[model samples]
Every structure is written in C-alpha cells, then in structure tokens.
Target chain A: MPLSIVYYAKEFFRGEWARKFLAAKTAPLVTPTYFRNYPELTGKTCTHHLFCMMACPAPGAIDVVRTPEGWMPRIHVGHCIRCGLCVEACPNGVLRSGRILESMFYDNTKLSFSFRIDVDTERCMGCGNCAVACPVNKLIDSQMSHGGRASTDDLLLKVNEGKCQVLHVEKCTGCKTCEHHCPNEAIHVARLLEAVHAPEDEL
Target chain B: MTVLQSLKNFVRSKSIHVAYVDVGSCNGCDIEVLACLAPRYDIEQYGIFVHNNPREADVLLVIGAYTPGWEGKLEGLWEKIPDPKVAIAIGNCPISGCLFNRPHTLVDPPVAKHIPIAAQVPGCPPRPTEILSAILSVAPTVFKDYEVRK
Candidate 1:
C-alpha cells in the first residue's frame, strides 16, 4: 500500500482507534457531577441582608443583584463549588445544603416543581406540626414501618417525643406547610428558581 | 404573502435583544431569567440575546413588584427604551406583588398600573421557558402595534 496510508493507519491505531478498541473490551462508568442543592425559599418577613452572598467562597457562585425591593443573593449553578457556605450564612435557615442527582433534575419550565424541605436537626424540637401539616403524611401508610406495626399517624403525633426526623424527602411536594406551621422555625423548604439539568452547551 | 410583510417577518424573527429590569422583586425571577442566558436554557438558541442596555433592547423584561420610590426611576427607564418594544412582566411580583403585596409601608402597587405591560408571566418565580414563550408571543404583537401606529 501507500506510505501515507500506512502512516495514517499507524497514527489512528496509536490514538483514537486504540481508545475505541479498548472501550469495546471495557466500558467505563461516567460519574455524573453532583450539585449541592440550595432551596431559594422566599418568605414574608425575610430580612434580605444577603449574608449568604457574602459568605460564598467561589467567584460568581453567589451574586448580589439589586431589585426594586433590595439587594438579594442569586446563585450561579455553573460556578457553584457546592461548598455549602451560603447555606450556613443564612441566619433564618432559609438556605439548606442537599445533594441532587444532576441527571435526575427535571425541567420546571413546563410544570412547576417546588424544593424539598430540609430540617435543621439541631433546631428541631421534635415538633409534630410538620408531620400533621404535611399533605403527603396522610398518604404514608402507618403500617409501613417496624414490620408493619407502628402507624404514621401515631409516629407523627409522638414526633415531638424525641427528635423530629425527616423520614422521606422524596415524598415531599415542597408545599412548605411544615415550614409555615413550625413555631420554632426548624424546617426550611427549598424554592426552585431555575430548572436543574445538565447544560446542553458548555461555554 | 407580500414582499414587505415577508421582509418584516424576517427581521422580527431574526434577533431579539432583551433587557431585564427588576423593580421590587425577590431575586427568584431574576435567577430564572439569568438561567435562560446560561448553557442549560440558552435562549440564544432562538436568536434571543439578553442585553444589558435598554437603548439596544427590543424587549424590556420588567420583573418584580413595584415599590413607591421606584415609580419615577422605572418610568424614566421605560422612556429610555426605544419604540417597537415589548414589555413583559415576569413573576408574581409585577402582576400582583405575590406575597409582598401585604398592606405595608414599603410595598407599592403592581407594574401594570405604571408602564403598559405587553405580556405577563405570572408565577412566584416563573420558569425560564414560560418567560421565553411570553417574550416570543408578545414580540410580534408589539411589532404589529408599532406598524399600526405608524
């Protein structure tokens, strides 16, 4: 054959061809990047000091944008390191650090989805208000727990007996009834402003 | 069907420059709006560009509930924006002030009472797609309105 053809064949075998041939033998699992979820909850009496923006370490992760009301913190998901600093800085427990499956993140543009509630375990006084107020709580079968022994209703009423624990986060609709009804303000519901999805085009 | 109409449609569909203005809104709608500029939503795919200056904007996106002091400033900004422009009120703040519409000293009236809203996207924080669609739907009407006036 020709010398150029031989050379080109050699280069392909050494570079992309070798990788593709090897890939046929063993496929590697590509780990999706995990995003630290921050619920963008807005409330009636929020002080709006924007200390969360101040606490962020990553540049452009949390930007302070001035609206007509006042300055508010806006998170840039692309730049966010998911360090959870902004969540810690929020005095009102407005921000909560959670993990979201980047691939499982849905588009809220078509159908609106609220953020799941994150309970500050330390702050929770085992108040059963969240359990009682939860709309999904009624759906949770009481017999599902403890070898089909204890009912959810019994557990909810006695929720304050020990410590309030968030049993099922996925079941939460982000209705924020628990957050609203909580006297101690232990529960913080996530407010989703942007749709969570892998970027279509990476800039 | 006609040459002039086709020419106008081509220009209208070619590019849309949007300027986002927040009066008294929680940063929720702003975040959603900014997401459209990000790689995920990427409104640029539709030839829509989020511009900073009102002078170059084809569409003015006014987000937030109106407050007392900002009336003069907002009106001034509105005046600065050139004609044949569409104004979209994104999120509940501009429409009804959402939760902030409480009878209080700081809260003002809605944006509709001040500047004429060509379109309204109502949500506590409207989805980026909703905002995008609202802009698309209203842009043609705004252009047609301008053409009629001329």
Candidate 2:
C-alpha cells in the first residue's frame, strides 16, 4: 500500500482511540472547569513526558518503568550515571570507578590516557597488595596494562638505571611505589611478563 | 483552566495553525521540533499543523535564539502573524539566554526580551518530548494529554 494511505488509515484510527483515551485519562490530571474559563492554559500545559518512556524498548537504558505492579526502578551497569554515587553506596564493594580519555585527530592519529593498577614486572614479587585493596573483584593479576602477551623479559621500561639514585634491591620493592610517586614524570614502570602492545591502526 | 480541555476543544474545532522559524540555533532544537511530526512524537495527532505563511498561522514556533541582525526580521514576522496568536520561545537560548547570551555577541540574548513571548521551553536543545509538552502547553490543541518530561 502507498505510505500516505497507510499513514492516514493508521493515524485516523489511532487518533480516534487516543483522543477518547486521553479525554478520560487526562481529566483528573488537569484542573476541572478551569479550561472553560481559560483556554490558553490548555495550550500552555499540554505535555507528554510521563508516557514517552513506555515506548522505549531498550533494556537498561531507562532506570525506572511503569509496570503493572506499579513503577519499578532497576539498577544496571549499562545505565550508570557516571556520578560515582552508586560506587560509594554499594555495600558489598562490587563497583569500581574507571576513567578513560581519548584524543583523536582528523589525520587518523590517536592519543589516549588510561590509569589502571598493574604489576611492575622487573621488581614485582607478586604480593598482590593492590589487587586485595581494590573494591571490585580481586582480578588484579588480570589487570594487565599493555596486554597479557609479553613476558617480564620482553617488556621494556624506559628508565635511566645509571642516573637512578635508589639501586639497592632491599630499598626497591618493585611494587611501583617510586613510579607512582615520581615527580619528574620520567619513570615508566612496566610488567615485562605482560604483552608489549601498540594501538591498532585506523582505517 | 486545564490546558488539556482547551486543547481538546481546539482539536475538536480544528482551529489553530502553527508556523516555525529558525533563527541562530545550532539546529538541535529544530530537529526536535521536526521529530514532533514523526510517528512517535506526532504533533499532528491533534489538529495542529504547520503553516507556510505567517499571516495565517495561529502560533509561531520560534526555534533558536534571535541574532542581533535577525531582530528586525523577527519583529516583522511577529507583526505579520494574526492577532490572538501566541509566540512560543523554544529552547534554552531563547528562554534563559544560554550559550548564545554573551553580551557583545552578535545574536540577541533571548527572544522573550525582543518579543511578547506567550510561552518558553527551557532546555539545552530540549528533548522532543519536552518540546511537545511546551508546544501543547502554549496551544493546548497541539497535543491532547501533555506530559512534561524532565
């Protein structure tokens, strides 16, 4: 059938039903007898926000729904507000906050900065302090920085070992304490055992 | 009076015609207003329909904040619209004088300052649902059961 024909037929029937339904349902929602005296308010307050979400079928997109049991509120990670309030409110330590920033150039160049806890392959004794301290699941060992493909010997950390003042093994725990606190911003603590990686080339 | 009742009367009588004008907006609000014509937001579900000529239109849906140069044009357009007609200021820029509100900027701060606005819809490119609510609020015949979403 032609699009306009389909539209007119569907719209005509829908309009009749909607008008009848609205006349009944909208009466209590608006002031009675007031419209007879003032018609402008009819134009001024006509709105449809309350019923719009009922049409959305996307799961986890909306936090609240008007179900047969009445309005129901659901919490899902995909629906996160990014406010960090839920993370702080969780009693079982199930939520953890993570941040990622990416800068893209029209020429297809990419620059990104991400912060995550990982082992310092050269010095790590695998004590797993950071993993245990994490609020989320203790999958700290799985939190590889580059990717878990490279071994400790294959990974590289650009460090001036000769200029480094702290040389003693007893003083260095290899737990990334110095890398975390380094003011010069030159030290890059790496997990050599993990995979060495680079950003994928863009098309 | 309840806007809903007046709206139903208007729809039953088939009385109002609306005109849309684009000023200095980023076109986001314009798109939302357009969505009202679609199946979901369906503004035409009521008797309201868009008019090409300002003189015939019962309501002027002004989208975007007016620019300084466009002030005279807007005034002229308002004069062209027939009396008893409502002027609706849609979007945050025209209502609250948002990002386009810089004093030295070329655009006028807000449409309300330049014209006798009948209603204002405030939003940073408000959702179409909100736009529909605002439209129906000003011209009840624009929609039947108007629900303003946050």
- Which one wins on TM-score? 1
Q: Tens digit of lDDT per residue, candidate 1, span A1-203?
A: 69999998888878677766533232322323343444464542335645565555544567667677655667654345455666545545445455322213333111123356677778877647667666566566433332222345333222534566666665665557778888898878875534324334321
Q: Give the alpha carbon lDDT tens digit for every residue of A58-175 in model 2.
A: 2232344455654443333222223333222222222233321111122333222222333335554333332232222123233333212212221222123323221222222234
lDDT of 2 by residue, B4-97 (tens): 6655555543546788888788887788788877776566655568765898887888877677668689889989986657788777667645
Q: Which stretch of 10 consecutive residues in model 1 chain B shows the poorest summed lDDT?
A: B141-150
Q: Which residue ranges in model 2 land beyond 4 Å of their true spot?
A: A1-203, B1-14, B140-150
Mark the regions of model 1 whose C-alpha exceeds 4 Å error after superposition.
A1-203, B145-150
The Cα RMSD of model 1 versus the native structure comes to 18.2
lDDT, candidate 1, equals: 0.64
lDDT of 1 by residue, B1-150 (tens): 365765675577557889989897778889999987777666776668887689988889988778777868988888888887768888767776666766544766578888988887865566677787787777666656334323
